[model samples]
Target chain A: MSAPSQDLLARMALTFEAQQFLYAEARLLDTQNYKAWLELVTDDIHYWAPVVESRERRHRAGHYVAAADESAYFDDTRATLGMRVARLGFPGAWAEVPPSRMTRLISNVEVGEQGAEDIPVRSCFYLFRSRLETEEDSYHGVREDVLRRVDGELRLARRKIIFAQSVLTARSITTFL
Target chain B: MTFDVSRLVDLENGLIDRRIFSDAEIYDAEMDRIFRRTWLALGHESEIAETNDFFTTWMGADPVIVSRTAQGIKVMLNMCRHRGGTVCRVDRGNAKLFLCPYHGWSYNPDGTLKVVPGLEADYRHGIDPTQWGLLEAPRVATYKGLIFASWNPEVEPLEEFLGDARFYLDCLLDRVEGGTELVGGMRRWIIPTNWKHAAENFVGDSYHAAATHASIMRVPGLEGAGGRVKDVVGYQAALDNGHGVGMWMASEDNARGGYGHLAGIDDYLKSIQDQLVAKLGELRATRLTPVHATIFPNFSIEFPFASLHIWHPRGPLKTEVRDLTIVDKAMPAEMKDMLRRHCMLRQGPAGTWEQDDMDNWSQTTYSSLSPTARGLMANYQMGMGHEHTRDDIPGRIDNKSSDINQRNMYARWAELMAMDPPPPQVPAACRSHSGEISR
Candidate 1:
């Protein structure tokens, strides 16, 4: 509504860079270059997507109530993910069999509070994945990431994914967010 | 393709009609004869610890409310007495009464009709207020902490139905001194496959592990507690009333074995060994190894993952798989956390081994409906007539590699289906607070 300020423009430029980094990460996943993608992750990363509860809108609005200390779809450390990523390469991994043809649509990127060690960013994602001939599965969700600068590069330290689809259509959730 | 329900299974010859997987008529009949009549697991007792505490779950496609009543736990249909609209829409909450949004008719946790907005002014016939209440499950019972209900009032007692399966169930439920508590909310999802595919797999099919989940076996540091996959020796127990259990550890003859390779697991288990013996005696406490099981119709449990399953049938071709994790009440926070992680990693919605099982099941459900496949029969002949009974151990025992569990379940299924029972008949209004179902 008003003339653009200098600090605001600088922050916009930083957010654009963060978006580019996320796009590059998505590109690596699309190409199935998991080994290279692993380098972009922090040594201590916590990737979590909790099992959501379908509750009344009286308190927590539709499917918003998630884990306190419960079972999650994913509650993985860097070491755990390393093994999982390694498993994707195996031929017997049926969920990944015929190799998923997928694309990540990442949008609404907004960099939130910046701490001394970490910068939090929020964005929404729609992962459209197809397998074999025509069995397609679409997953839409929001991701909150706490990224940190490591060796002059952004690395994910923590990621929490919240899905819009309460009843997952896919038979298996093997692909990453 | 048409199928006679009577000929769906031939356990004497170890043959199962492929039509059972995809036939619409048989699935509908199953809902009548089996699901409606048999005891269905609803939720755990710890869920509704406080008065008015409630949890909503499914017994098949029907929505059920398991509430902690002033008297005890009550299982009632979620439908309102007024226009049959869903009254308690929330998944779970602590509610004093369930008020119908359509007409504001409220019922207590015990299914008693508590409130009727402007009732005396509206009615001319002087309809008794007691006649209007929630439609509750005819029979509700709890074994350990698991709550189950059956529409058929004449159904066998829960303990009698569970029978020998209780010996193995105790291995999971009664392991620690205080027993286990559900570790938070459930992991519920829909899989496009017949419910029986998931049920039978958990009931009997350990043979798939070495082949189906071969990739998961290669995960580093996942020898899985006492080398479960490494030492692939165990026994499959074929229990009565279609319930069966498989214990997959080397030589389950004794109660003492490696507690697993986890740093604190061995010490924790060793600490509880004496208490476990005191609580459940030596044979039951030690003999039941951590493993996979099913309590006929739809309920399943995996002891190794500390998880439970209810394969609710959505239709002949779809299933809603609700998975939950349970941890010992007395376990340390860190151990509970690890068990949750382990449950998620191994058997939850995005689990390692379950992914493969889902794939096989998806294909089986879709392909079995073909004309050629429908005419053909699926085989369960691996050690078909080799089922043996152990006097020391309960129920019929068989080699882990055998199809005895599957045979036992199908035989029970055919036997039940032959009864040809009617679908449940619930009253128009609420049931009384005293656990009575009016005609």
Candidate 2:
């Protein structure tokens, strides 16, 4: 076989870069460094996690489930995201008062076409949270994200989380997925 | 399966036994006494706007299908009559027929049996379709656009059951001429807490906001700005039939759905202020701004968020929190979507204000399981003697942060629990088109 083309090598390098950026984000969230994680997102971030429902294949075209503009778990902008981070700092925020120990496992990184300012990346995440001795929750989902370059650093512009469960088993989703 | 209701729920002394929170036998009794008798809000009219549109939900432990036919809305048990399998397994769809997966038994949108696989060959067409139809709720009614159904045919009319609470419910539902519609789908999550905790919390537990949602107060415009957090100034109305509402004193800033922060919504409500006054009368239109309310057993409304919550009891120790966001039909599309999105910042499973609530609720349920904690009675003495009827208000009025409403709720709960279950009537589905039994 002939040597790999330069374009192919550049694509591979970009994919590696995108994978590393996501891994760093996972680390920040797992370590409960929400302030630092907030820094890695762009000023105009749109983080959304729409509610999913179980429906038959024939009902796919109908409003059997949440559509793009429908109900969601987290529909956060930059300002609202900052408020969530601010809430985590308060002692009276009882959900996280004892502070859940979390571990984020991210894999299956895939990079899309190189845009002028942003690159689309897809990854799977398994977020495990354990709190108060025995209470534990695990959320597994795929993240469709747009990573853009801002001030010579990669930052998250948009993230759309799609979960596997129809009904959330966890009581409250205080931490970001 | 009989227990002492007076011992479990003692509202006279403003005391409630811990056993009621985690008792298995009491939970089963509630399924029969409360869920089967009271009017349960299943879905909104907009959810099943067109004919054959449907959604599956739970009425207590029973799975139910809420569907719309050409005639009207029909609520029926989702189980198949033949082998007790669910005819409709999906969450929602527009289906003309629901075919049971276990067997090929099809049901019409109105819950009449449409077909059986071996109708011609097996038993030589012995089965009468009407007689073998799905079991349906005998009493179905709608207040505004919210559809409610009761299993007991002898149950009171919807308006009579609602009584004085309709005045407050209208503040949320009848604001616009076109009425309200849910914004897309629903959010459901499970929490380890008794369902009553959620219902009573909405009834008159604004006092918990200071400690439970202290973090939300720091957010801009939620409570107050510049370090002057607004104190709770509201009236708790303990109405008949166990319904309760908590309304904050209305102000010019709050006519915009209670928060002065939502400038866009405020301006929109202002443009139609005169129409509101005309529709709801001057006082109700301008003065009563309901913060939170519960229509007895489980259905709850949060006005500022424009959302409805159904605290479905999973067991004695767990609850399924199902929620829907409501919006005015006359509002502009952008404003409707904005209102839905704005509510997400403060409610739902991930909402800042509600996130802390689950911790409190679950812990309260869990701590009640301890042997040491079981011996003690929970306190409900706050603002007890302050309950009095106000001429302006329509119910037993109490201080905004009073436990009078809680006591009122428990009193009704005990009254219902002590009564015998209503005898089952012939299901409406078993009757022919002329309202006669098909047999």
Candidate 3:
């Protein structure tokens, strides 16, 4: 790979900014400031966690946690995500009453080709998570992001996280990864 | 030190000595006599149908790689013999040899140590590579596509170990054509509660459906789906070797009524019912319904929902549960998608029902550790004296969702705990003086 062009660097700055945006988002999540966090994404963004299986000899199989054919953990449109965020804010979301603390570290930033005015970026992320009043839990994975520069600001058009641990250690992923 | 056998076997009343749950001594005995001795479900054979296919999972905290070889599916310890490093670290992938990241020592898919990083000249044949592959789990066997492994080499064959459970499983597994293929991948999560809670919950606790998942019934489409929208009916049947099955019938009159009535369920049964009836005949298909049951101790199959094989490892003050859910392979792409969606919504980390269950389970463990709350008995008395022994079946049977299943589980736990040497006892002062703990 040759050195990234200045224009690409300028474009990549949004990717870097997107990384920062994601970092700030993680902080909001860790602190359980979900209402403030909800403003960061577009109304149409899709959040997903795909489940993979290790078939003997075949290596990795199956995609999507439930399965792509099946419903998703949160196959939310912006509206559904909003509703979920609202639900989390309620006092009765017992799973989050104590609230889970999360720290998402995004690194290894690499910019890929631009598609229809949007640049695709890939980065490695390690999430150090802990829930209050419980055992320490964490998740690490790689993030593939598609960023759209909207009105001079980078917004996450799409974000897909492929986690390394097939099985989660947390009591429940009540909060977003 | 040995457990007080007399006190542990109080079957009349469901009171188990509080010592059973928190005692390190009892836990260690269980590891040997129960976890090690039983035919523990490893992974589905469908996972390793082809040579070199492999899946990494834990069999009672022992990391195991279930792989397919020329001979067939085999379960081997994930730890390399050269060093204790995990031979295959990636959750699942294909490779003819498992190369250790530490020293670059490699082993064939068959688990034969094949290469030593510096062995060409450094060792001069001093190390016997043939004997240094991953250690084989003592006993590995399969019933239908469900593969099981045992640490004890002398454990009985999977068929004999399954015994009467086979009758139910055959109906569950063989009834479907081409058997079942795991759809999507297994939804894995860690729960803070003991594994027994999960086993018993799925085994026969249909009574909790109306309450624990009352919200699900309100999900619009599912309200009148299976006639299961309202009152829950419980049916329990205990199989041999402590395995059991339970049906939360739609109603008492229609014990197996509305078997194929639920939205996702009716579709699922329609897709496979004919093939299953063709393969296993009507007798078996008619007897089974959309139900969930355990293959003793750890493995559980939830028909029309998900199939979970669990591994519960007890730490000093904590417990970790690993669950795997499987789906059918032949269903339409759209239906499969719906099934996966339903499962994720209901059971995964973000699942609605799972969220509540995890909270309860975690709180159970957390509260059980309180010094002031210690010894508070956790009640399992949902339905008492409702259990009866059937002449044809191997274990007990009950009319409704009763603690009979939980009692059966504890009964097995007590049995396993008794089979091995007990751990050193703690002083009287350390013991909780409280009567019983409640969740």
Error of 2 at B4 (Å): 0.7
- TM-score for each of the candidates: 0.94, 0.94, 0.78
**Clashing residue pairs in candidate 1 (N, C-alpha, C atoms within 3 angstroms):** B133-B429, B133-B430, B134-B430, B226-B260, B255-B286
lDDT of 3 by residue, B45-159 (tens): 7667678988787776567788889977778878767656888876665679988888888889988888887786888787766656677775787777778888777677878
The predicted structure with the larger TM-score, 2 or 3, is 2
The C-alpha stretches of model 1 lying farther than 4 A from their native spots are A1-3, A62-64, B226-232, B249-255, B284-288, B428-439
- Model 3: which docking level applies? acceptable
In TM-score terms, candidate 1 sits at 0.94
Give candidate 2 regions above 4 Å deviation.
Answer: A61-65, B221-232, B250-259, B425-439
Per-prediction DockQ comes to 0.73, 0.76, 0.33
List, residue by residue over B1-439, the lDDT tens digit for candidate 2: 6678988877878999888888889998888888888898887999989999999998887789999999899999998988788898788878989999887999999999998999889859887777788888998899999999998888999999999999889887897789999998888888889999999998888789899988877766444211101332588999899989988665545443434566476677777788889888776776667788899999998887788999988999989888899998888988888878777777777888888988898888988899899889999888877889977779899888889788888888999899987665555544346442221
Please give the ranking of all candidate structures by lDDT, highest first, separated by commas.
2, 1, 3
lDDT of 1 at B281: 76
lDDT of each: 0.81, 0.84, 0.65
Q: Is candidate 1 or candidate 2 better by DockQ?
A: 2
Q: Write the per-residue lDDT of candidate 3 for residues A68-151, one digit (tens) a residue.
A: 443234555565456556556555556665666677777887778777767677888776766665457777777777777778
